[model samples]
Each structure stands twice: as structure tokens, then as C-alpha cells.
Target: RDLNALGGLAKLMPFTAIFTLIAALSIAGTPPFNGFMSKWMIYQSTFLSGNGLLVFFGVMALFISAATLASFIKFYTTAFGGEPTKLTQNVKEVSSSMLIAKGFLASLCLLLGLIPALILPLLLSPGKALANVDLSGLITT
Candidate 1:
């Protein structure tokens, strides 16, 4: 899609705009979001692996995160930040069913971010059991 063709839908489609913003921020790995939690775990694992290649991967991940943040900023501004273009001016908010689904997912993202400990064990358990390792202690340290 042409970025130039989309602009300023926040007023026209407030719900859609907001959900899109949340999705963008989550994808960008900003703090207090699930994306950041996942990336944090990844960085920690890579750094703690004691392997040169893994450490390098952590650095690359940092760079990629930054790039993702910048790109999303531009996208959100163009699509929902500024004044709506002709193509977007008449667009309506998504259906209630879709909104409910997006809202549920957004809430889960916030819940996972706000209380990551609640989900962390469930995530780490299978890995620990399969590898027969004390990954929890490694993560805490």
C-alpha cells in the first residue's frame, strides 16, 4: 500500500487508529509491552549463552529493534497521526466483532507486559523440562 495515500484516520476511525497504534508499539518493542518482554528474554539468553556468535546476535537484535521503532513511528504518523487523505477520509472503524478480538489481544499484550512473571513460568517450563536445565536460575542471574 502507498503510504502517501493514507493519512490522519484518528478522527475518522478512532478505534481502528488506536488499536493500530497499540499493535505498532508492541511490534516496536517499547517498554511495558509484550514485544519488549520477548525481546528482553531473547537478549538475555543470547548474552548469557557465553558464545561469541550469540553475543553478536544480541547486538544485531538491538539494532533491529531500533530500526523497527523508527519504522513504526513513521507508519503510525502517516496512517493515523496526520490529516486523513482522500482515500482514508471515508473509512470507518472496524466491526464490533473485530474490535472485540483486537481488544482481547491488546489486553493480553498489556497483561503479559504488566505481569510477565505470571506467564514466564509457563513459557520457560517446557524448555527447562526438555533440556533438563535450570533456566530459571540462569534468567534470574
Candidate 2:
């Protein structure tokens, strides 16, 4: 929580830093990432409804996404950039098993981002099951 106490960890724990970077960027809703796609789908549905109130909320969601990006940028640059502070100077990378786990999760994130169609049907299953909505049109490349 105290970012002021952290610095230059990327040099000490390069692998961990990379994984954290992926997590940060994905959550920040950067393009071609799952986070962005999820938001896009919600915003698309909201705007398509042509309701002013939902449109306003959708715009607010975009602003929130920007704020998320800014916050994560601060998080990455402060924790991974600059000279190491006393607290982070002796930090070490995690075990190989942990790295493997992180790598698997990171790959999944990238996959979902790059190929949303792969999961869109699975994700929309409940909606289809309940309402039998024709959601095939909502699927985007």
C-alpha cells in the first residue's frame, strides 16, 4: 500500500516484475486485453440500448478505466522503476512453480484478449439459457 517505500524492484526480481506488469496492464483495460474486451462488451450493450442514463454510466465507466490505467502506471513505475529503496533492495524472484503458475495465468489473459470469440459463447451461455437471446450478432472478432 505504501508505494513510497517501494522502488527498483524490476532489477531485483525481473520475472516477478514482468508477471506483475501483465496483471497490471490487463486490469487497467489496455487494448487487446481481456479487461478492455469485457468493458467494450458492456459499453457496447449499454450504448446500443440508446438510453441516456445508461450512456452516461457507460461514459463514466470509460473514465474509470482511464483512472485505472493511471493508478496502475503509478504502481508499476514506482515499484519497478528507479533505484531500489531499503525495503526492496534485497527482494528476490519467486520460485519456479510460482513463475509457472503466473505464466499460465498470464497466457490465459492474453488468449482471452486476443481471441475473445473463444470464450464469448461460454460466457454468454447463462444469458442464452435464460432468455434465448440471439447473441450471435454480439460476437466480434
Candidate 3:
């Protein structure tokens, strides 16, 4: 849908707005979301590498992350906040199936963030085997 059409639709479609908000927050790397976990690991690894250039890039990454956060905040607020426009006057919540799918993915984002250890083995196994490195020790500490 066009950007103008989304104005005020959040009230008509609250659930979808909520889902979008969660996804946006996750993408922005807010804490307790999957994106934050991966970004945190990246920053940690970059800093630990002790390379001057990599450290500079890591700082750049932090600035980029902040920019992303601001952009998403503006997007969510503009699309979902304020009074309903003519185009959004009749908007309604989406079907249950769509909501179920979105809810499932959003919950996964939370689960992955809160307990990454559960999925680390599945994620690291192939890399571990290919590189002949012991990632178990790395993941635990």
C-alpha cells in the first residue's frame, strides 16, 4: 500500500500494527529481540579482534544501528499513529492465518534472543565441522 494510505490504519488494524512494530523493533536491534543478539555478537567479536580498522568499522556500525532505529521509529509512527485518513477509514485487521504466521515469527524472535544457546548448536555445527574449530567453548564463554 502507498504511504499515504497507511495513515490512521493502525487503529483499524491494531494487531497488524503491533506485529509491524515488533518486526521493526527487531530489525532496529532493540534488546530482547533476535537482531540485537546477532548485532551484539558482531560488536563483541569486532572489538575483541583488536584490529584498529575493524574497531573503527564497529563504531561505524553503531552509528548505522542508531540510524536504523530512528528510521523505523519514524516509519511506525507515521504509518500507525495520528487520526485515520480517508484511505484508512475502512481498513480492518487481516485474517487469522496471517496473524498466526506473524505471531509465530515474532515469538521466534523473542525466543532466539532470550535463549540463543538452544539454537547455537544447530547454527554453529556446519561451520564448526568445515573449519575444524571447537565452537562449543566459544559459545559457552
- The most accurate candidate by TM-score is 2
TM-score, one value per model: 0.91, 0.94, 0.90
| Candidate 1 vs 3: which has more TM-score | 1
Looking at candidate 2, the ten consecutive residues that score lowest on lDDT are 132-141
* 140 Cα displacement, candidate 2 (Å): 2.5
lDDT of 3 by residue, 1-141 (tens): 577566876888888888888889889998898888778877876776789999888888888999999999989988999999887788889999999999998888888888888777887789788999866665532
Per-candidate local distance difference test? 0.86, 0.87, 0.84
Q: Stretches of candidate 1 above 4 Å error?
A: none
On lDDT, the leading prediction is 2
Residue 14 displacement in candidate 1 (angstroms) = 1.1
From the highest lDDT down, the ranking of the candidates is 2, 1, 3
Write the residue-wise lDDT of candidate 2 on 1-141 in tens digits.
Answer: 798899999999898898888889899888777887888887897777789999988899889999999999999999999999999878888999999999888887788999898888888989989998868687555
- Candidate 1: lDDT over CA atoms? 0.86
TM-score, prediction 3: 0.90
lDDT of 3 at 74: 87
Model 2, position 44, has a per-residue lDDT of 90
